[model samples]
Target chain A: MKDIWKKFDETEPSHSSIHHLMAVYHLHKKNGYARGIDIANYLNITRGSVSITLTKLRDKNYLTEDENKFYHLTEQGQQLVNSALSKRHIVKRFFSEVLQLPAEVAELDACKIEHLLSNETGEKLICFMGYYLSEKPEVLNFRLGFRQFKYQCQSVAECRLCESDCFFSGKEISKTG
Target chain B: MKDIWKKFDETEPSHSSIHHLMAVYHLHKKNGYARGIDIANYLNITRGSVSITLTKLRDKNYLTEDENKFYHLTEQGQQLVNSALSKRHIVKRFFSEVLQLPAEVAELDACKIEHLLSNETGEKLICFMGYYLSEKPEVLNFRLGFRQFKYQCQSVAECRLCESDCFFSGKEISKTG
Candidate 1:
């Protein structure tokens, strides 16, 4: 746990860089071309920042810019985006479908961690979702019971999750800060 | 989705910064006090760097330093740490208990996203686990069926999760780069 946060930086395309690449993919799909300005507009960032990150992405061989200045994700870039997108879907579905969180919170939470999740974990999560959401009898019964069951975790002393904080009573983080 | 990635930066504690505070909390609990040097030693980072971050944390009102230069978390700091730890536990349990992932993998994945998950999502997830893991007959039957269900997702086209990448076939990101 001490240095696991550093592993966050080990992902090939960083969060910002991956989003830049995704801009290229989505813009290309919708408009048939993507340029620096298009990406900046897509991501709602300054064009200068987009240019700087795109140059690094090109140097790393994840994307390419044609002589006409239109950008596109390379096979490697596409793979990374694809991996992230799949992970996003899995986590989003888990939050919204299984946990009954709102669709918007689920999507944003998924986006925050999509590029960080390992391939194995992503695969395993989807498999779990698949089984839990399947048409099997036991799965159906479980989903119904789970939906109707009420949890009664009371005080911190009696709670199994009081090692650091209790989710039920921790003050909400001021997101504006 | 355009700027949702930026929401990652909106968390009160950056991933590295949160761990620095947690180190102080752990060292104090284990040894009854903490100092900049102690945090540096615990995190295996340079002391000068730790001092810089500690100053920033103090300015942000998350921690304090005493006469002998011992460090302590303010009430605000403890709440943030608690929230992050609870989120970490919920995710770790989901990965290991529900998804049946390996312990080490599950822990690392949880660490990677602990501070980033929204508090609402964390609470909802734990409640879901509470019901799913309960001794109710439906839950037990579902667990047994799920443990034995072998998923066979063959390719991207027929898969429900092929919006971008196929987890089963995506190239493992080279963490070394």
Candidate 2:
């Protein structure tokens, strides 16, 4: 558990890099071509940083540019964006539909982690959400009971949910984020 | 959705930095004082790099050093770790307990996103898990039924679980990550 976070650096097409790839995706979809300035505008990043990132992407074999400076995703780049969007889809549905959180919260949270979640987790989440949302009698009963139920953790020691720290009382600290 | 990934920069106590703080936290718990070398060893980072990160942390006012160079978390630093740990706890339980993913996968996935999730999602997940875990007949029935359920997607167009790309069939791309 203590070491898992380190693997984040090993992930391909990291959260920001995926978006850099995705900017190409969305821009190509919107206008059929993506330039460095166009990607910079799309991501709201400065041209200098975007060029550095794009150069890294190109050097890594994820994308390519034509003589006209028109950028395009290679097969690898397209797959990264596709996989990220798929992960985002399931994550958003789980947060919004099964948990019944607001749509905005779900979208924001999913967007933040689209590329970070592992493929196995993404696959399982898709399966779990599909199973949970089925219109079976048990699913219906559980949903109704869940809405009427309230969760109250009396103490950090007794609370299985917060075995580490008490977020319930961390109102002051949460404000810092 | 395109803009949300950029906000990751706005988040303080970033994923790797949180571990720097956590190294201080665990070292303090284990040794009553954290030195520059202690944190570097704890995080597997080189002393030169850890010094740079620790100095930045001090500059940001999240931690401090004393005459002996022992490290300590300020009130704000402690809160950040507390919140991140709390978030990690709930996320782990959600994946391992409620979603019933493998424990190793859950732990890995949760660690990857511990410092990235919003406060709202963390709180809601805790409440939802509490409600879902309650010992009610509806809950039991649903749990039994969910394990028996299977999720099958015929195509991307027909699958609500996969809105953007077909992860179900993307066996080739998943290995890239």
Candidate 3:
């Protein structure tokens, strides 16, 4: 079957909205209230931009504002945050466990992919991964070779470790030196 | 624990680049090759924009192009795609299983979350979810109840026919409704 990612590619979302939602979710989780300045500092963005987004989120009932410059997730807002958190976990696993990407790249890619999948397919993937991890631990090990490669002294050793049981056996690992 | 989403409230990725990547990924998956026009049609974007993005991806070694208007993922490009796909699965599961979001919202949120989490956190989450799903299925069910409520559902029964125990009581079901 065609991967679900291919199907949902047509309806990609705005990255700003996703970013705003994540910021709100994290802030609320850290402390019951989050300020625009704190969010800006954490994300390395301008306070002006954060203020604008906070205002928008408040207007949308995703946030409640207080006199102390703090914002909290409303019930509606909490629901959105919860969903966002779930997506964050899934994306992270896919990168680190399934495709065996480097930590930095996997983390970034997970953030992007979390916004692109459909509910049905996403659930199936989770189920599949769960089953695969339980039933086929070797797959997980093979997929996670990318992360392991970084700690290895030689790239070929990393490739050999992976190739011993990897599905993509024919592909040769070219030496860097 | 501090949720991770709070770290990106004002940050936004380069929209054109992300959109272009999505378009190319979609087209390549569909036809095993993609041209500017194919990407344009799939993404509802201009052919000129597709051409520009394709040139950029080619230069970056994410794509290989030829006279037949076809392009394929280079080794580097394949790595990126594989990584993205893995992360997508992780994000999807977190929303659907851990957060117990409805299929629709979980999928949508997963798409957004996939791009935001750090690899360390993502891996930790995977380990947590894996253990949580297997060891304490009941607590997870209760969490699912919360998710159902968040989506405005009256109760878990409203979403599905209970065959096992009720989430609230952990008692076996007697009827369909």
Candidate 4:
């Protein structure tokens, strides 16, 4: 879908750009500021590349650089980083909970999804699923099982139950029933 | 972190390639077979690009193409497509539920995340979150609030608990609590 591509495009950080952003975020989070060489070393990238990225980020008002080679996120930069982090968590939850994907995959996927999702859609989805789980705990188990099987390569038919007892078990029913 | 890049690099699909694959999947799902022109037309991309991507996919044994342009996904290809679809749903749910992101953003984010995540991480995140939600619903609510404040352009200290309670409470909690 065009929409899908658009989403992908929005989140498709130039590999280098994302690398730089992450390095800075990490360094800043741990230390008060980050030096270019330190970031380059951590990222296993060239110092020249880190310098260029830092220059770009500074120009974009996302970073503040000093003579000491140390850099810090500007207010705007912090906002962006926070947003990215939140989106990443959301993506992780989505893969883990709804799709029942494995932890490694979910984390990887969240990195990509966090960049792509529009604010509106992401919020709505979280709200809806959270509400569903709270009100219908029983359905949550069923859905989790279904999602797990689906992730593990089970066919829909294979996951379906044939016996009445299966449906009538102690599991609580929800509106979807 | 290096491992993360390795997975991302390995799974990264060229834009044209993914478009071609999605077109093929859509056409096959709708009509049981996909033609070259049909894919080209649907994607609004050059036939040459489509042809090139198709050739690559063929080389990878993801599809079977005949001289007449008729094509179908190989079992491997079908499996991949199914995985993509499942990821799409997870992404959607994640934005809606955990992040409380808007629908548009969530959908967009999910699309991006689906492509980036490693299968293992994706599955693990889902399983853990599912268990957490079932075992500790309050934690889910806390996470929801935390994410909302963290990502919604508001500082955690700035969030109004009364407002959140009003918004998250009630009988239709399943709808969008």
Q: Could you tell me every candidate's TM-score relative to the true structure?
A: 0.91, 0.88, 0.46, 0.64
Q: Model 3, A1-177: lDDT tens per residue?
A: 223333343442334655665676676667765788878876767999888877887787777888887777777666554454454465566556654556665556555555454434444444334433543344344334323332221332453222122222233221110
lDDT (CA) per prediction: 0.80, 0.79, 0.51, 0.56
lDDT by residue for model 1 (B1-177), tens? 557878977877799899998898889889999998999989889999999999999999999999999999999998788778888887898888878778888899999899888888877776776676768999899888877776666566666644535645433221111
lDDT of 1: 0.80
Residue B72 C-alpha lDDT in model 4: 80
RMSD of each: 4.5, 4.1, 11.3, 8.7
Q: How would the candidate models be sorted by TM-score, starting from the highest?
A: 1, 2, 4, 3
- The 10-residue segment of model 4 chain A with minimum total lDDT is A160-169
Can you list each candidate's DockQ? Answer: 0.48, 0.51, 0.08, 0.23
Off by over 4 Å in 2: A169-177, B169-177
Predicted structure with the largest TM-score when compared to the true one: 1
Residue B24 CA displacement from its true place in model 1, Å: 1.2
Order the candidate numbers by DockQ, best to worst: 2, 1, 4, 3
Report the error of model 4 at residue A49, Å. 2.5
For each model in turn, which proportion of the native inter-chain contacts is also found?
0.61, 0.63, 0.03, 0.23
Q: Best candidate per lDDT, number?
A: 1
Complex DockQ, candidate 1: 0.48
A-chain TM-score per prediction?
0.88, 0.85, 0.64, 0.68
